[model samples]
Target chain A: MNKREELLTEKQIRRRTFIAFTFLFLFLGSAILGWQWLHRQPTDHGAIQPLRKVLDANEFIFSSLFSKKHFAKTYSKDLPLPHPRVNGKIGLNSAFDTATWKLHLVKAPGDTLLIGIDEIKALPKTEIIFDFKCIEGWSQVTHWGGVRFSDFVKKYGLDEQSKMMFAGLSTPDDEYYVGIDTKSMMHPQTILCYEMNGKPLPLNQGYPLRLIIPVKYGIKHLKRIGTISFSNYRPPDYWYERGYDYYSGL
Target chain B: MKKVIHKHPLAIRWLHWLNFPILTIMIWSGLLIYWANDVYRLGWGDRTVLKFFPGSFNKALNIPFRLAEGMSIHFVFMWLFAINGVIYFLYLVFSGEWKFIAPNRNSLKESWLVILHDLRIKRGLPPQKKYNAAQRIAYTAVIIMGLGMLLTGLAIYKPVQLNWLCAMFGGYEWARAEHFTITILLVLFFLIHIIQVIFAGWNNFRAMVTGFETENIDAKTETAMPTEPINTKSETDEQA
Candidate 1:
């Protein structure tokens, strides 16, 4: 009985020692695997869907929280706004007769109104001097004078509860389309700009009309606004399909 | 008729070893990034106590003045560092290993006693099975510091995008300063850890590497002992 007890005790001792060693090994191996896994390229598409969903949810919450901060600065008139060279013009390929040009406001079914540039000039004009930032990590300061987008929205009685989830801007031939977020479209800084540097916008700078929004990147500023539409569905964004965050706000 | 007993598991040994290279790479790449804006210092006015890096240090390191490459490498490796850290944390938490690493209520006082004993100012040592009180404190502190580094790094990286996080760290420049300070503390911790490892000598080092140690079992309870009887010298140990 004594010998048997001794043997059992020895076995238990060895097992305990073995368990300790096992734990050490588990931690060490896991740390190494973790290190390697982190360095590996992000190739799992199954993982990305969840991440994108989280990002979208977080963005909505964060944007709503930050929008209430009353933070705006006055820009000096003497500050020279750098004129960055135009990179690409997608929808402005075809020419349109100025006399025939009409800024269409799509309302109820068959209730669309054909408004001219002279009609836009008749509204209250607002001029802003602000910086225009590009995603390529460069910025330019420019003076834009135009009618406030909010003014038009209010003129047309577009309230916060409006069902329009999408805002679409297109060039004359509709070759290019840019989408604006409803929040940005209703922002006081967003304008249907017609003049640059105290003169009517040059032909190269979207002659008839363009978007001047301080809250967004330069890519969303669609030049030569031919038609503005309000829709329930998401409007197709020019840069979004090419892999960019949809809510590309400042 | 005696054999060594395994102490450290294979996993722990690998993780302990793997940390060396990953941490080294992170620090090296971080230095390269800091070279772009090395504005850290530890001095009151022009007293000249300590600058972040001496001119000689920069010369030896050969850090480039341009930020472009430094930024690229830093950004790329940051993902790896963060992912590894997150996984390590989750593993510890889920596997119940956090109990060992996390300090108990007595840890602070015991850590001071352990330090005194290690410094040879005190005779008796604290009761320790796996980690001494000092080790517990150091390890726990480093994890917390790692969290600080991650937070401060994010604050600096996306100041406008993560404006709230930036504000939490007391704004952009403060966050940068905090990040650099924490990094310096980590490097100091590494230096001290290596020194302690060397001080602990061959048996401790071998245990870490080979996952085995030669612990002695008394002749009277040789079979009852948890470890195998081996050639281990033990001086008289006083209770804490």
Candidate 2:
């Protein structure tokens, strides 16, 4: 009887040992797999269709909840943005032709009005320094001088109840574009920036006009403004469709 | 008479110890992320209540305002934390260790009795086994929570890449909040686990560290006991 008990115990012990070694092997195997996955450079620019689909669905669901009023309260203003970095050279190619530039306003379908840079200059110009956050984990403090979006709206009589959203200025070539919600457009810091860091807006920084909002990441501040539109329908955003949050607010 | 017996295996011992430092680093790095967005709290509008980390807590930790450093450390250490967790879980599953750790239908009732015994309200001592009902419940619950943390952590980390996971966890922000709360729960569990280990004393503790325990052989029980006796072959096989 004692011998039988001993044999059974021994069998159990052997099983445990086998299990332990198997687990160790599996651990090494998983680690190797993980390392391979991590080091593999992104081969497909738009590869992994299933993963992208999952990501898109997740973005839609997340944005819906994130834009909820209750959650927005957690988006605090305490964390300051760092020095803005240069990224995404879209439409700014040659020197900005300030002479030929016209800030086109599309109030309604087929109702487009063109305003020159001189006209924008006629509005009340304001300057302020604030951090410019980026979609990537970086930011920078920058000085911007331009007419406030609110001032521009008021001057053109565009701040009407019917106008629910605002679009930013970019080159005639639709390489770069930004769309902002109504609340962000009226923000005191939102500007049609004409100068940066005490000088006229650099050629690379959108010479004639650009949009700058302290409360948003730099993506929303479209450079080289060519056309501005106000609309009830959501405007086409350059980054939103690319998995970034539509309301890219700070 | 009570006799000393081994409870935790050597693999478990190493896994348990490894989790200590790895989880600590994870939590510390998570704190850095949380500090940047420390907006969560438990209270209604108007009257003030408890804050997450009062000024005193920050002062006590002396955590510097270094976001870059925080991010670097977090990204680097996350690999170790995640790998260790995955290995631990797989080990349990592959080794049939889940059988012992997982709670059964009788677990709830047994857990109440165990609790009552611990509180000194019950007359008789609890059943002697590798793990009591309370231990099983706590252990199983923590494992489940660990899985939860992983899910929520991934949801927040790659919200754009894994948007569906993010949505399932409520959202990116909610996942972050849930991850923080789970860390708090883990810390609480750690405290209780440590206290329990200490209360169990040297034999219990030594068994974990050394993978063996010295026990006085009861001659009568050895002869009369119906179960198989623990022998050298079983010990060696189990130890392996």
Clashes of each: 12, 16
All candidates' lDDT scores? 0.68, 0.66
DockQ of every candidate: 0.09, 0.06
lDDT of 1 by residue, A1-250 (tens): 1011112234444554577567657866776686567446352222223333443454475466435132222267798667755755787778777668888876655777788898888999999886565544344567889999988777766664244776877887887777776767777778899999889987777878899876676778888888888776657777655434455565
For residues B1-240, write the lDDT of model 2, one tens digit per residue: 224345566677778766766677677766765675566677899654867667787668865463333444455566667778788889888877777878888888899898788777987745645678898999998998888888887765555435578679886567778887898899999999998889878666665554544455577866775564445545667569
Per-residue alpha-carbon lDDT of model 1 for B21-52, expressed as tens digits? 66666777678767755666777887767777
Candidate 1 segments whose C-alpha is farther than 4 A from its true place: A1-250, B1-6, B217-240
> Any runs in candidate 2 off by more than 4 Å, and if so which?
A1-250, B1-4, B125-128, B219-240
Write the residue-wise lDDT of candidate 2 on A172-239 in tens digits. 67777777777667766678888876678876777788888765666788888888777665677776
What DockQ does candidate 1 score? 0.09
User: Chain A structural similarity (TM-score) per candidate?
Assistant: 0.75, 0.66
* Per-prediction TM-score to the true structure, in the order listed: 0.52, 0.51
